[model samples]
Structures are given as structure tokens and as C-alpha cells.
Target chain A: MRDIYAPRIHGIDTSEIRKVFDLAAKIQNPLNLSIGQPDFPVPAAVKEAMIQALTDNKTGYTPTAGLVQLREAISTYLKPKIGFETEPDNVIVSTGVASILFLLFQTLVAKDDAVLLLDPYFLIYPALVKYHEAQQYTIPESFDEADVNSLNDRLKKDGKKLKLIIFASPSNPTGKILSETQLRLLSNLADEHDAVIASDEIYEAFDYEKRHVSMAKLSPHRTLTLNGFSKSHAMTGLRVGYLAAPPAYAGIVQKMVTLQQYTMVCSPHAMQWGAITALKTGIDAELSVMRKRRDLVYGILSKVTKLPYPDGAFYVYPDVPIDSADFVTRAIERRLLLVPGYIFSANRNSIRISYATREDILEEGAGIFCDMVRELG
Target chain B: MRDIYAPRIHGIDTSEIRKVFDLAAKIQNPLNLSIGQPDFPVPAAVKEAMIQALTDNKTGYTPTAGLVQLREAISTYLKPKIGFETEPDNVIVSTGVASILFLLFQTLVAKDDAVLLLDPYFLIYPALVKYHEAQQYTIPESFDEADVNSLNDRLKKDGKKLKLIIFASPSNPTGKILSETQLRLLSNLADEHDAVIASDEIYEAFDYEKRHVSMAKLSPHRTLTLNGFSKSHAMTGLRVGYLAAPPAYAGIVQKMVTLQQYTMVCSPHAMQWGAITALKTGIDAELSVMRKRRDLVYGILSKVTKLPYPDGAFYVYPDVPIDSADFVTRAIERRLLLVPGYIFSANRNSIRISYATREDILEEGAGIFCDMVRELG
Candidate 1:
């Protein structure tokens, strides 16, 4: 048979996280720390809201953008938190932050477009850029003032102009939240290069050390803030998320909504009702629990390997002494599932451990990881 | 500000159906015959299943392709109806059929690839092809043996090679189900052109005349059957759908699943559990109600306009005497929402009336449509 797929299909190879999931599925009760979603059950109130919506016959399609109440609720929720007065018009509710990101890329990024990335980023960033045939440039050194200047110099030297810059803070694998000063510098870089900043704030609620800041706050004129309830309220399966565009990008947001109409049609209708309830519900208690888990995991893993102290999100990326792929393979053999750092960065000396699991599992998984590092080191 | 969007964004213009929706939103208690979804509430069993799933805390992410049991249920459901033995591996559950179509087109169709669209098609087809920069060829004459032959000749004359053929049976506007002979002929054409068949069977349950024949039944080697519970079980808001690929297209299915992983991630998880229950439930009673509504609608409209006899789905496309857009405008003035035929086809002399609303509303809407036709004609 003829090859019935486009060339772009080859670029979107399955991520290593999926491989970890596939491997974990075979092992009985593996001490799993490779998952990215929160392990907490959805709050009772949110579940009841969705149930009520279903019972009320809200099972038909909502407007393509989403339910009006949900959009308004999202706007109200973000106004205080995102440090901006947002209106319902600025929001486009989607299946998840992942889906919104997909639409954003499809709408904005094109062939040969320069998409800048931070090292050890969300695994989807490179794949999305590659899928669009965009030119990808990553700052692999470190996230610092010096690194921003180095990135600017490298771009100028290579004669590359950045079209889009994507980063998740409190990032997925690293859980390192960028400082306000760092955000300002990157925002300035975006202004200099005339690029759009896609700030993935899905982990916004997970900041442990300080208050969470959004790129939407630092550079509202050019930043697209991506967030969802999956992690914060533990509603990953509901697949509801939204992207908030600044007033300057309302036209572009409209275009993304149109694309979404042809693609997702709309997010699940009943779930949007649940999301409305979630906006009013706080996760402070849950955040405290995760904060302790983060402290415990980092405390254990740091004993054997050098890694950055994660301040946000639920993951810690540790620089292992042995090959990270080999380290993960050995960990799998020990009935522990962990993702290698190559999935997030070109570098292969580290592994990402998500502390989103229960405390006992996180503790046991971290111990197993440290033991493996010592044996292989 | 710089134009922060790709050129492809311009190709996906918002459809006229959305315009109708916007206009209808402004009207109070409009006799609505413009919506595509079934008006029936989601079945009680399905709703309870989703509620149960939520209560059981299946609110975390499922595997990207969807829950294993849902995939298995989908396979089992299709095996007898599609005239082929299906396995769970051949299925990929997605957010909706529209979403699966998006992934399928993104995975397979590339720029300049020729896509064959049946005329008066679902509005999304042309937009999807245009967004991909694919060359689109439509058979706008009629749906019959002659039209298929004419399409083959036209393709040859234009020196165009067909890469894909997309059609919905028990189609949206026309509600005309393709006969088994027609399916066999189109399958032969697909074989001749070496094109893949995307049989959109979302309205499979809406067939009232004869057994709905799927292209998959005739051309399993090169067919991708797209179906969902949205229309059948009235779970449109739940956004759960699946694609069944033939054994020959397993590799392509895997690629689409990967694309979906980076995009939709998975269908709303709890909804998939509901879908599993939906597969075991019957919608024959509700389908019968729609069948009678179809008869009521066609009977009234045929008195004033020329249209094909609709045997399935919930819509009837009638050729109106006045400009179809103007007719829709006039209808809106009278608080009757109808979609212009040009929204679905190049021809502008017809309009689509959905009988998916209540029978009284359908009757009143049909009467209003006839009165307007007589006055304008």
C-alpha cells in the first residue's frame, strides 16, 4: 500500500512519557512517579456540579467557544490571579491546555518560524514545533539572566528571528518557576524579537516557595496564558482548559476559536459547568500536601544526585551520574517508572521524577531512584 | 503589532452555521431548525454511567487512545454492523468525530494533495482541506451513479490524483443515505484512485428506510469509519467519539493516536466510561421519533420547493425560489432559524431545515418556510 501519511506525521513520534506509561501498565503496583497529572481525586463539589449539569440536560453542544458562564467564571478567576482585568471575550475554553496549545500553534506558527524554547521544557513543545516544520532554538545552558543574554547573542549570530517562545513554569519535568526578573528579561526579549510568548501556567497553583506569577502579568500585550483545572482540581479526565489572550491579540484569539470550531467543536459541555464550580473552590489544603511531598522527594533524591531545588509544580529533575536512559531502564527493572531527561531536553544526564503520586509511593520511588544512582554511579 | 499568525489561519473561516447560531441566540423562542445535534437528552443509563464514573473518581486521564474497555466495546459494537471482525487495537477513542477527523487529516493530508468531497457535504470538509493547503475537488452535480462516474472523469481530465474521499452517510443537510450499490461503486472508485475512504457514519442510527451501509463494509482495506454516540445516545456535550481503522491502516492509526496524544490527550475520561454503557444501550425509540419528524418536515416543505426525499438524519435541504441567504434572513425576522444551502454547497438556491427540534416546532417551522417560499416565489 502507498504511504498514506504526511511527512509531518513522522516528526510527532510518541513521547517517552507514553513509553513509561506503557511499561508501567505491565508492572503490578509499580512505584510510579512518571505521571504528570495530579493523583488527587476531583473535589466533591465540582463533581456534583457536573452531575447537576448532566441531569439538567446540558448534554448537547455548547457554543463552540464554550459555555458563557464558564468563560465568565474563568475571566473572573484570572482577573485577581493573573494581575489583569480580563473579560469573557479574552477566553477560549478548550479540551485541555494541551488542546489549546495545539490550536495556538496551528493558528500562529508556520514553516521556518523560529520557536524559542527553554531547556528541559514540556515534552510537547519541541514536537509541536517540529510538527509545524518550525525552526526550533533552545537555550540549553540554564535559566538565568546570563542565559537570556546568551540566547539573544546566539539568535543574532545565527541570524534567526524568534517567532514564538514557549515555556511551562513551574515547568513539567524541572518544576523550576522562573523569577519575576527572569520573566521581565524574557518579556523584553520577546519584544525585541517581535515574538509571541506562550506561558504554560498549568502548574500555576503548585508554586511552593513564593506566589505564582504569570507571563500574562509580565507581558500581557504579547503573552498567551495557558492554564487548566486538570492539575489544580484533579480533573484531568474531564479535559477542560482555556487560553487567555490579551486585548492586543483578540483577533488572533478569534482565529483560534474558529479553528477550534472546526476541530474540537467545543470542550465537553457538562464539564465546563463543573469548571465553573472549580473556579470558586480552593486547593490550599491539597497544595500543602504536595508541598510536603516535593520537600520529601527532593530531600531524598538530592542525597545521591545534583539537581535544582524545585520550587513549583510536582516534579524534580535530578542530574544522574549514569546515562539517564540506562538509569530509567534500571529503575523500571526495580519496579519504578521514571522518565529520562532526554524527553524534555537534548541532554541525557538527568531523569524527571514526578512527586504527584501519594507520599508513600513518592518516598519509596525516590529511595529506589537514589539506590539505582548509587549502584550505577 | 506584527501579524502574529501563519497564512494557514486565514483559510479556516468561520462557517455559516456559526453565524446562524449567533443570530438564533438573539431571537426569543425561535422555531429552531438549524441545529445539527439531536434534541433528545442523553439516555438515562448513559448519564448514570458517567455519574457513576465521576463518583468512582475516574477523573484522571485515560490512555491517549482512550479507555481499553471503551475501545473494546466500540470494536464489538462495530463488528456485526460493519460486517467485519474488529479488535480493540483498530479503535482509537477521541474527543469527538470532528476531532478524530482533524487528527486524521493532519496525519494524512498534506499541501497539494487532492481531496474528493461530495457536494452539499458537512461544512468542515472544505475548511479542513483548505487549512491543510490541500487541493480539493468536489462533485457538485448529484449523488448517483452518474455523479461518481463524472467525478472520476473530472479528476482524470484535471490530472488530479485523489488522496482522500470524505462523505457522511445519512448526511447532515440532505439526509440522503447512500445505497449499498452506491457504496460498492464509490469503493471501486477509491480502489481505482488509490485513495482512502473516510466514511462519516455519525448518523448511522438515524436511518429509517433501509439498513445503513458503511463504506467500511465494502472497502475495509482502505476505509476509516468515523462514528460516535453524540447523535445516537444524545451525548453531544460529552464529546466522545471513535475511529475504526482497517488492518491495512494500523500504522496510520498509530500515527493519528500519537497526534491525538499531543493534541486532545484523551477524550474526557469519565465520558468514555459512559460511552461503554452507551454501546450496550439502544436508541431505537428516540430514532423513531426523529423518523416521524423527518416525514413531517419533508411533507410540508415539498409542497413549495424541489428537494430530494430525505430518508435518514434529521434534516431536509430544499431548493428555495429566493436567494437562500435572503431567505434565511427573512426567516430570522420571523423568529425561525434556518441555514442557507450555500453553507453546505456551492449552489445557493436551497436551504437546510433541521427537524431535530420538537415536532410542534418542526411543524410550525415547516409551515413558516412554505409561507415564505410562496410569498417570495
Candidate 2:
């Protein structure tokens, strides 16, 4: 057959995270810290709502934008949490935050348009951008401080070429949460650059030190806020997320949703029901448990030299004494799994350790990881 | 803000189907026949399986490709249906055939790559191909006969520039099923021209006259068969579709799925469970009910002078006696709604009426449509 695969898509390598997952899947071990999914079951209220939806026969195609009630619930939920006032018309329920991000990339990034992505960002961003034939410009995060000057300089210089800026607050690999001031500056810069900021707040509920702030709250006109029930309510498998944007962009995004109609008609009806319940009844208790787990894992990991203070998203980015890849490989050999920082656009010397496990598993896994570090040293 | 949205994306027009949908939504008292969703509920077995999955807490991200058991089930099911012996690894459960089609377009159609689309095609095909920066080459269908010679000549003239060919068997909008001889000729032409064929068989189960034949069964190496439960089991809201391809191209498609991880992580676990049950237990009863509705609507539509024969996919594309747009507008004026064929492609003087509604609704809607056609004549 003729080589029909698109040139831009052929270059995406197999996910490095999946490689670790494959290794973990092979082992017969009981505990798994390798997966990005929350270990907790979906909240009972959410599950019950889904069950109720099924019993009600709410199993037909929803409007391509999504169920109005679910969208309204998301809009209402975001008001107090993110300090943004959004209407049902502004919210589009997606399969997950992943799908929203994909739409954001497709909607904002053109064949030659450049998208600015923070290094040590979620690994999927570059791949999605490249899939749209857009150029991905990685701006390394200055860990020295949550500095906005470097980013501003880059945005000011390459602003015209840049179409979108995507970053996860309480980011993957690095649990770096952008402060309110830093976010404001970034939002201002994005507005100045005429670039849309796609703030991924999927980890909003899992922040330990402080409440997460959404860039959308600061600049609603130029921001697409993406979050879901995946991490917050432990409904990753449910595939429910929402995209909130200014009404000006809703028409365009809804058109993209029309295309998505061919892909996913709408978020699963039962899942949308679950999300409605999740938004109506909050995830405070769930957040508390995740916070406690975050603290427990951080307490154990701090003993290791050069471990940055873990902030959020059930992960700690620690500087490994050895190469991060080697440390991860050896940890896997010891039957413990952690994502290498290299997967998140970082150097190979730092590893990401997820803290979403139970206390006992956290203790055992952290001990193994520390011991492995010492042995390698 | 200097329009952060991509110019290329903004340049593409909003879906014409959605415009018709908006008009339908605006009508105060319309006998709606415009939507493509199955009016039936998902099979009892499917719903029960989903309920069981919810109770069982089968709510976590499946393998990026999809659930192993589901893929295995799909493999087993496809062997006899497609005549292609495939392993589980060759199948990827998608959000729907729409997503798979988008993935295939993104993977194969780079900028300037020409994709041949059968005209009177699924409306989304051209938009999606255009979004990927590919040129769409329309091969107007020969309504009365399968004209392989002309098709081969056109394909041969384009040769390497022709990256892909997309056609729906038991076709959408038209509902005409491609005969086995036509399938063989097209597949052979694709192979000879070194082009990929994407056979959308989402409507296969609704075939009335003959058992459906998968293009993959005829041309295993060059064809990608797209199917899902949305139509077959009335699970449009559930969003589960599968792509069956040969092992060689599976890797490329898998990579695209990996990139799509953010948009939809995996099809909903609950829906996947439901789909497994739907596929295992045949949909003969559901098909019978749908056929009855189809027949009722067809019998009514047949009375309209210029309307064509109803074929497959719960839809009847009939040439309207008046301007197709005017016919639909007049119908709407009289509280009846049907999709104008101009939305499917330009200059087609027809309307697509979905016959998936209940007997009473179908009868009422079809009566209104026939009255409008008679008045126009």
C-alpha cells in the first residue's frame, strides 16, 4: 500500500509513560504507583447519579455541545472556586480534559502557527500540537522562581507567531503551581500577544498548600479553562470534562464540537449525569483524602536530598542523584514504578513520583525508592 | 486581542448540518426528521452490562488502545464479518467512527494531499479533510450503477496524489449499499492506485435487502473498516466505535490514538462493557423494529413524486420536486422538519429524512413531508 500516513503524525514516538506502564503491567505486584489515575473509586454520589441516569434511560445522543444541565452545573461550580462567572452556553462538556485540550489545539493552532508550551509540561501537549501541524515552542520553566519575565520576553518576541499557550497548573512531573501574581502576568502577556491561554486545571482539587486559581478567571476573554472529574472526583475512567471559554469563541469551539460529533456524539450520558452530581455536591472530602496522601508522600520524599517541595497533583518532582531514566529503570527492577521527568519535557536527572497511593503503599514505595537512590550513589 | 484562533480553522465554515439543526431547534412545533440518532434505546443487554460495570467500579482508564477483552471480542466478531483474521492488537476502540475518521484524516492527509470522497457523502468528510489542510477530490457516485471504470480512470490519473478514498457502505444520507462486486472493484482500484480506502460501516446492521459486506472483508490490506454501537444498538450517546485495520497500519493509527489521549482517554468503561454485551448478543430484534419503521417511512415517502427509494441507515434521501431548500422551508412552515441535501454537498436538490423514529412519529412526519412535496409540485 502507498505510505498514506501524514508526515507530521508519523514522527510521534511511543509514549515513554506507556513503556513504564507496560513494564508494570507485566509484574505480578499488587501496588502500582505508575498510573496517573486516582486510586479512589468515583464518589458514591457520582456513581449513584450514573446509576440513576441509566435507570432513567438517559442513553440517547445529547446535543453536540453537551447536556445543558451538566454544562450549567459546571458553570455554576466554577464561579465560587475559580472566581469566574460563566453561563451554560459558555461551557462545552467533553469526554475529558484531554479532549478539551485536543480541541483547543485544533481550534487555535494552524498548520504553521506556533504554540508556546512550558517545558516540564504535560507530555501530550506537544504531540497534540504537532498532530495539528502546528509548531510547538517549549519555554523552559525557571525553577529558580515562578518568574514571568522570561516567558513575557519570549511571548513579546515571538508573540505574533504564537497562537496558543498551554500549561497545567500544579503541572505534571513538576508539581509547580503558578501563583496568582504569576498567572496574572501570564494572562496579561497572552492577551498582549493575542494568544489564547489554555489553562489545564484538572488537578485543581488536589492542591495541598493553597486553592488553585484559573487563568480564565483573570482573562476570560482569551482563556479556555479545562478541568474534569478525572482527578478531582476520581472519575478518570468516566471520561467527563468541560471547556469554558468566552462567548465570542463559543461559536468556533462549538463548530469543532460538531466535528467531534462524528468522534464522540457527546460525553457519555451517564457520565454527564455523574459530572452534574459531582459539581452539585462538592469533592471536599475527596480533596481532603488526596491532600493527606500528598502530605504523607511529601514527608517521606523530603528526606532525599534535592527533592523540591511537592505542591500538588499527587506528584513530586525530585532530583535523582543518578540519571532520572536510570533511577526509574532501577526502581522498576525493584518493582516500584515512577514516571521519568524526561517524559514531561524535562532533563533526565529528575523523576516524578506520584503520591496518590494509600499510606502503606506510599511508605513502602518511598522506602524502596530512597534505598535505590542510596545503592545507585 | 489579535485573533488567537487559527486563521485556517476560522476560515472553514460552520457545519451546515448544525445550521439546519439550529433552524429545527427554533421551530415552535416541528415534526422533526432531521437528526441521525437512533430513536431506539440501547439494547437491554447492553444497558444491563453498563449497570453491572458501574456497580463493579470498572471506572479507570483502560489501555490507551482500549480494553484487552473488548478488543479481543471485536477481533473474534470481525473474523467472520470482515474475513480478516486479526489479533486484538490490530483493533482500537475509539470514541466513535467519527473520531477514527478524523484520526485517519489527520494521519494520512497532510497539506495538499488529495483525498477522494464519494459525493453525496457524509457531510463531515470534506470539513475534516479541509481541517487537515488536504484537498478533497469528489468522485460523484453513479446512482444507477457502480462505475468502476470511470473511478479507476480518475484514480489512475491522480495516482500518488490520491492519499485516501472514503465511502460509506449502506451509505449515510443516501442509504445505498455498495454491492460486493462494486466493493471488489473499488478495493482493487485502491490497491492498484496505491491509495487507502476508509469504509464507514456504521450503518451496516440496518441493511434490509442483503447481509452487509465489509470492505475490509474484500480488501483486508488496504481498507480500514469503521463501525460502532451508536447506530447498531442505539448507543449514540455512549460514544464507542472501533477501527479494524491490518497490523502494518495499526501502529500508525495507535500513535494517533495516543495523541488523542487528552480528548477522550478511552471510550467510557461503562459504555465499553455495554458495547461488548451488544456485540455478543445479536441485534436481530432491534434491527427488525428499525426495519419496520424504515418500511413505514419508505412507503409514505414513495408516494412523493420525485423521491428516490429508501435504502439503509434509517434515512431516505429523496429528490424534492421544488427547490430542496424551499421544500424544507415550506415543510417547516407547516410544522415539519427535514434536513436539506444542500448541507450534505452543494447543488444536490434533495432532503435526508431519518426514519429511526417510532411508528407514530414516522407516520406523522412522513405524512407532513409528503403533503409538503405534493403542495410544492
Highest lDDT: give the candidate number.
1
State the DockQ of every prediction: 0.85, 0.65
Among incorrect, acceptable, medium and high, the docking class of model 2 is: medium
State every prediction's TM-score relative to the real structure: 0.98, 0.94
**Candidate 2 ranges beyond 4 A from true positions:** A111-114, A132-147, A151-162, A247-252, B140-146, B155-161, B306-308
- C-alpha lDDT of residue B223 in model 2: 80
List per-model TM-scores for chain B: 0.97, 0.93
Query: Per-residue lDDT for B30 in model 2?
Result: 68
* Residues forming the 10-long window of minimal summed lDDT in candidate 1 chain A: A140-149
Residue-level lDDT of model 2, residues B142-178, one tens digit each, is 4323455665566567663467889887877878887
Clashing pairs in 1: A95-A239
Task: Report how far off residue A110 is in candidate 1 (Å).
Answer: 1.2
Task: In candidate 2, list every pair of residues with a backbone clash.
Answer: A6-B107, A98-B262, A98-B263, A99-B262, A99-B263, A262-B98, A263-B99
